[model samples]
Target chain A: MLDQAFEALKTYDWGTDVAVLAPIDEAVVATSGDSASREQLERRLAAVLAEDVSRDAKDYVCRKLMAIGTAASVPALAALLPSAELSHMARFALERIPAPEAGQALREALASVAGSQKVGVVTSLAGRGENESVAALARLVGDGDPAVARAAVIGLGRIRTPEAARALESAKPADPQAKLEAIDARLACAEALLAAGKKAEALAVYKPLAGPQQPKHVRLGATRGMLAASGKKAD
Target chain B: MGGQHQPTRRRFLQTAGAAAAAPYVITSAALGQGAIPPASERIVMGGIGIGNQGQWDQEAFLGRPDVQYVALCDVRQSVREKYKAKVDERYQNRDCQTYNDYRELLAREDIDAVHVATPDHWHAIQVVEACRQGKDVYCQKPETRTLREGPLLIEAARRFARVVSGGSQRVLEDYTELVNKCWSGELGPIKWINVNVGPLSQLCNLPAEETPADIDWDLWLGPAPWAPYNALRCSGSFATTGGSWRSYVDYSGGGMTDWGAHHFGGATFAVDVREKQPVEIEYIADPQGDHLAFHYDNGVILYHNRPKTENLAVEGTPGQQREAKPVPVYKGEGGIYGDFIHCVKTRERPFRDIELAVNTIAVSHLGTIAYNLRRSLKWDAAAQTFTGDEEANRYLDRARREPWVL
Candidate 1:
């Protein structure tokens, strides 16, 4: 039943209705919180993931795995971490997986994936806001590959902790694109700080960028940031 | 979904798999196509004023196989050729045409519609001309640079019976979705709506710079009175914000109307003010720059640039205000580009149709005029004029350049 739902999932887009997934979706929802039912679904989904089913079908099952997944579902999702076609959906499941094993699986693959793949893993870590991954993120902040380095900068912004803020302030990138990205990331850290109620620390981040001495775009952003932060309370 | 797959939009969807993952993508299906359908239902389009926003508008349509950009136009020779080359390269043919003037592009009988990405000053003239030529228009926001021109554009659109859409697609998301909730009284008679984007544009004062050889300075200054060409004014898109031409009163209405049209476009959906206009407009004091406040006959107020939040804020009755939450920002699925393609096929009026655009632009224009004159103004919405205010009335439209008659 779920396999045919995957077949319909492969054919859908924004232009049409997705109601065809209702029957299998009802089955999944009916089995909610039942470990035995979830295990069976995950096993079936894992088999389909390995088959030549369209990436959309795989993405659909991975999202289902996100809701009812156990540590048992990690291997099927973790196998996709290296695949550009499937990694995003894999991270979608991994990010929501409450089990520590899901995170451990991501950390184990962190060292092996390179280029954009590494960037993807780093992004998943940030999305999970895994504080344990901060040191790993700091090291990649200045990676020689600009895409990797830029992704690391954005990742630090997403992690949004004081440690992440400090890492962003200290990391340096040689490439101009990466340098611009670092500047933007530092501001992102400041926003994260504001969101966390570290008002003075956030203002401190803005002051230097606001000075006339910084680049025009940088100064403009900093000035606006200060103006916006003046009296508004963070919710 | 089989054989002799020519290039239709839905057909392109199945084959173009997972090119890039977007936060906005509801399905990978929006990204790819497997069966290219026949060309009989294909929408042929021309892109006018292919500059910054023009290129952004063009980019959305370029990827769709059903909509083909047969002609490109721009005052700048370099910008037009750059787009021409891009269109040619994408189609793998030299059939894509180029023109310096928008009117010449509108003359092509083969084209079904045109997307207007020109500056504010040129919006009404270009949109009207395209409509007069029986071409549907997808025009950029703040529908007119001046108040008086909005009606004229709408008049032309109605007379031609063209499917005219204002380019603010944010209003297209279920008229965008939250409005339905607002109308359902879920927000309990919204007391005040804060349409916060940013402050209005001030007068242009930058020192003029030498015109570049590649730019046709004369053609770029079309319709609007001549001003010295500064490179800053000529440049487009800064760090993802709207382009530089928006800063000048002579060219665009600055930040206020540019984004105001979009945010208010959403706000009006909630307050249900499509046909009626705000009875009064006033500029409230700000230490940095002035912001606008408009009062409706219904006693609901609309504030521009007064809120801290970027999204439209609906403050309901006391208890509701205490419980209010930010709305999901509306972005049309497939965006305005997709909406236009759908409208072209269905022969339906788009949600952000020209008159709706005129009403929102009028609200922004009222705020802008009040800011410029530094005083409150009484409005006669039916008259489309200010009540007993002569100086404010002068701002309705500027005198067109001698040869470029409106």
Candidate 2:
């Protein structure tokens, strides 16, 4: 039944009867506890990505990889990261694969891809909170592309490590919009720091932004962050 | 981290003085000649995803004398233009702006609040972003698409000090009788309750069709996995059976979350567990069929589609009396809508506060996972993970398509 499902997947396309793929879904569930069976299934699914199958078929495999893929499936998924049409689904699996190799593959794509695809890779790295990619992302905080720069800024904010906070503090964007994004990201980083019990670091980010020169809302956020960091209440 | 505090309205009223100073014409409309409030006193508002529910929410806000509806946004050109025209007609001006992207509307410093009726997938992103932008939110029900989104949404609201109200009128209005019974001590220490909802959202494989000119297909599929543009695939119908985005796993939890927001919300509220989530979910496979039993830390169990049990059915300790407690209701006038407006004016948490709303939807999501894996599971609500179950944990959240992050 699983073999038939794999055979059917080669022809799967959008609008095809999903029932034809039910056995594969069942196989995923059936192999839950059996790591050997799960690994075999993962290998087979990854191999299909290299075959001449429809995009939908590959998409289906990526979704399955999301559930069972490991470092072994990283190479196949990473190969699709350069294709504009396929990068998203590939990242969809790599983003959740819980393996260091998947994060490394995404980090490598940072240089291999460009435009929105690069933005997607930065986002996946941030989503996984990939601390190793912080320096690479920090370098892009002032990228020529506004979208790429803004995404990098927001990604660092989400990462929320002290190093990520420092990256936002050091960024010098030419664009006014990017400047505002940096402030927002810094505020977000401070909030995360305070929550993670790094009061000194949180206060460092909040102190300067709390000044009158900043926007009213940003000042308000910084003031609140400072008070919380100081173990005081915001009246 | 401290108790939720309600800020006074005096500070807002004081800030309005500057804007009030700029106006000079004392025209009839300026004075709010009829029953309407003057422009300076009105809550400046905008609408996102102006489709079925969005339209309904827009009408409710428009009818208010204190709400100044100013903008409409939707990925669909037709929907936004149509709604923009209606707002312009109602206000007797061409001032109502339209945007295909919600970010532009949210960027407006003038818009004090926004009501979002976007699909389940867009709820968390829009709501959190709206909060960050300093706009109070009146987001539609099933406010979270995944379990991971719940805490983040709650934090955004609290961090920004925004008044976010979840759209679930039925929780209080529809289940009034049962809620009264439970809270009034008429049901005597409720042992368990059953909420019948769902046939979990399935994978979508609907064939690709010609992309319509009226819709921004890419924006419509924002954050969700890419799929071909089929009309039925993106249709805003309430149906959860392959007819609309609601039926697809990428977009929704099908009825499990669509109506589950109402049923599970109503059930949890009735049992006074609106602030809590189930700590354990026991999958029951009986001769009749399969169902789920969710155990709360308070020792109250919520059964999802239990065998032969009617919806919102409760089994309480017979004839034992318990102390009555006050049943919470919407503040101010109108129903849920008015409650939101009132909270926006003052800084009180709305009746359907984001935290409570997220708790309500968490039940639906947890049940969806258990049913998918067909096994009992343990949940640590504080940690927001499945204890000792890596496979189950994978379903906590999915990787959103590019440029959209939580």
Candidate 3:
């Protein structure tokens, strides 16, 4: 039944059926409880990318692979990373693979579609929270897309590595939205900086967030950081 | 950091400097990593249902040097004129036009996003249409008046690439951190979450009163089941405190969706109840009780009809009230609004994005449907429908008046 659904989905009008079948197909694979059907779904998903079809088909296939959540499709999905049309789907699928190899695939694919796909690639990497992508993602924080930049801030915030502070500091700004986002990023950066014993610089980084006229979001977010930093200092 | 792909200092300065000037800065560094601008460079804001909530939106944006308050639309001319004066005072140099219809607002290319605080029934249509127009949205909580509206709103947001966040601000509260901690398994596995939502006194089989001269009765009644105007539902001249907004099922979903969105959306997020809808709802009523309970599939329960705890005293009891203190779900002022501004800049999902609110909405709808149907409801979370009840299924989705598709 799962294989039949997968095949039905391939020929299905990528427009209507793919959208309708996405969650249904995923649920079928999820509830099948049969190992053979799972492999069949995975094979169909990985190979569907190679077919000439609509963008929805690619997305449908990616969602299916994600639903399977297995490592076997990693190689097949990874191979499509160089295809710009399919790479975002591949990255999205790879993110759901839930294995070490999936992270490795994302890392290899990261440089392949460097400029146009940073947000998708970085968000996928962050979703995995793999340590290997930390340096790469931190660098992308300084990259040009606001969405990509914010995703990198989130990646650093999630990773909380010492090196990420310099990256955040170099990119920090007074922009309301960026400042709002950085409220936590600043706190995260402070924690990371403090962990490295750069106390004064950490405090300085959070001080302006305490000022009046600062956006309420920035002030609130920064105040929390200051409290945490101050508590650590008192201790 | 050193490679052929690296942006030059001059290029970095230009992009970074531009971000520096924007409300939500999208740095080259952050951009290179993939952060969609929190909002567009041009903040084309629109309003639907420009009454009190609409008036508040004008005040919210009026003098803010950061935003351009582009347009206002409401069903009533009086309400529109009142806010127009307020806005004109704020931006004396710029002319802000008012419209009696919301569809015309959707037609304006200058409008980039909309602030929807319309009546309960109109939410799904106006929001879905705005998304189709490629406008981002800030919609009030209880994203839908009914259960079926959730999937359509979610689909619309996905289809349009718009950022739709619910106005249920409790998701933005600090208490939310505690809730997230609980969900992350730090506060021990939550065996049961009791959500005490209301005082049920809000719904009254009240006698109808006179409709005011300045109101447009029919447009206000758009898509809702037909009912005559009453001062209680119209001017809300007699509601209890801040919740007079609840008197009309046409304008609001009583206390169920109003406070339900705040408490339920926050609790749903905290309890990891964001993905699925409730399996059953059994509303227990006693002649004297102030709250009701909504039960989910995972053994979690939300008690909405009364208050049980003493430390947290909710100022207003749910029924027929107006001018009450803002409910404290998130432990802060400006609950979801501040969080959204923050999320926009940071590009993280705020406490109540459309996706999260959809499930919150579904849960709210289930409670209302079960109450209206006056029976226990067996809901299928995956298919998002009720089992074995055709009459109940009809209430799940609503029919748009005309020309609206999700």
Candidate 4:
């Protein structure tokens, strides 16, 4: 049955781009068909996850497992999350499943890595937009590394859950760059609230930014948003 | 009857005897002829442009019994006579057709496939025209002269569902295993790839020799800008194939496009970077001034001109018996012919897919653009246009002369 899936992908009308990708992806999809049962899925995942394959094959496996989206494979995907060698596709797949167990696994994974990988994971988790994920991102705003903390704060604004906005309000900026980023994060938070259909609250968030001290473009954008929120035109 | 039935189980065996006799079985007429007919269908072969490379190609195809040499075409009578004599002597049959024009040769109903060794400029038109007429093609390397020619050739082949194979076949060896090995991430994520090949420069810098009476200088120039015949450019008598080929801007992309098309095809396949174009390119002339390197979005650096220090060492671990001799970095030989036959049977893409050809042409054109502008440039893959540059687009596709437009 797994072989059939592999064959289908090979013969699939993937156009030229996907056809080039089929061979590696076929193998990963084939592995997923090992068994629908959680026990068998775990066993197959253990064997299929190899750090040594070509980057193409690794990416293929990541996409395939992510597409499966079974809670059963979450443990296996989570296990790989801690490894710095894990591909972004694999990390994103884990984020997509978004089970409480998966979120906890991702938090643990983020705690273990350093540098860009950590930033990537934190950003990915926040992008999931889970309230738990937003809170974690907000906490990262105080991380010792200012770049990471700034990324975390930006990620929180992107997440835009109510919990995230509250965390951002209370968090301290580490430097001038961080201060500028906080303003951007606040703007993002306001926009995300508007997108979420909280028109009154979105206007309230934007009203405070109508000041000369702010970047000219940001101040103008804030005033424009406030007027649009109140159902009036701004020149 | 059912009182005492013993279980019968099928057992598999690998017999050394049968293994040893496998070759003999294939060679045996009775068994072989029963399963597959001997001389079942003749592969009718035609040759166009019987220049030095074209003549050599004829001999290669003629060496096979399956290929029936039906037609030979060239602008020169001497070339026609030379191949006709060789074919007649070998086959002991004088029923072969000869023509001075390739269009006449392509028009024949009997020819199944054509071997096109025409000049760089004529490749696209001849190949596309042949495929449109339902003829499979074996075109010589560089596949096209410019970016504009690649898609036309690819579209023509695909529309006709014809088997059109490039002349460079090295990429298909062991399925480009070594190249794939590099992409497989074993080479520590390729920091650089240096091609020992570069452009075929024009030999017109030398004093012009008189045009030979027998050569069709006009046809030889074909779509290239017309000029009085220089013996050095037309016959290539004074230039080494590499030196002459690399120098010519009109006929070739210096070795960069010619050999780069073949080698870079493998590099892209191995790297799994077939889709994205190189985001940025900067050409560096050597202090002694021998070569150039093309950098890519994926951090892969491809150098052509002179060999670089990084590409000199072998890539992987030594074999069991000895320290690993450097695996050869590139393969250059009868790559075009060997792979064409394989694709014909297997119905699979030859190592250089048409898409790769298109992308490689786009990449190769960068060098020409750089040389002409005498500066580095940024390529925008999304816009399919160079950023902040209108002058560069002019060189991307050259205007075909009268009577030829793609």
lDDT of 4 by residue, A113-229 (tens): 767567657755654556777767777888887766877876676566667777788657846445645655676677667768888877776877666655333465578777767
TM-score of chain B of 2: 0.94
DockQ, all candidates in order: 0.01, 0.42, 0.01, 0.01
Worst 10 residues of 4 chain A by lDDT: A9-18
lDDT of 4 at B122: 83
Best by DockQ: 2
- Measured with DockQ on alpha carbons, how good is candidate 2? 0.42
* Model 2: per-residue Cα lDDT over A1-235, one tens digit each: 8999999998888878989989999999889889999999999999999999999999899999988899999999999998988898999899888889999999998988998788889888887888898998999988888788888998898788888998897776765445656776887899888989999989989999787766555676788888899899965
Each prediction's number of clashing residue pairs? 10, 3, 54, 23
Model 1 TM: 0.54
Model 3 chain B: worst 10 consecutive residues (lDDT sum): B311-320
The per-prediction CA RMSD against the true structure, in angstroms, equals 24.8, 3.9, 17.3, 30.0
Error in Å for residue B98 of model 3: 1.1
Q: State which docking tier applies to candidate 2.
A: acceptable
Regions more than 4 Å wrong, model 1: A1-235, B1-37, B172-181, B238-243, B285-291, B307-311, B318-333
Model 2 spans with C-alpha error above 4 angstroms: A172-181, B1-26, B319-321
Question: What is candidate 1's CA lDDT for residue B210?
Answer: 76
- Which candidate number has the best TM-score? 2
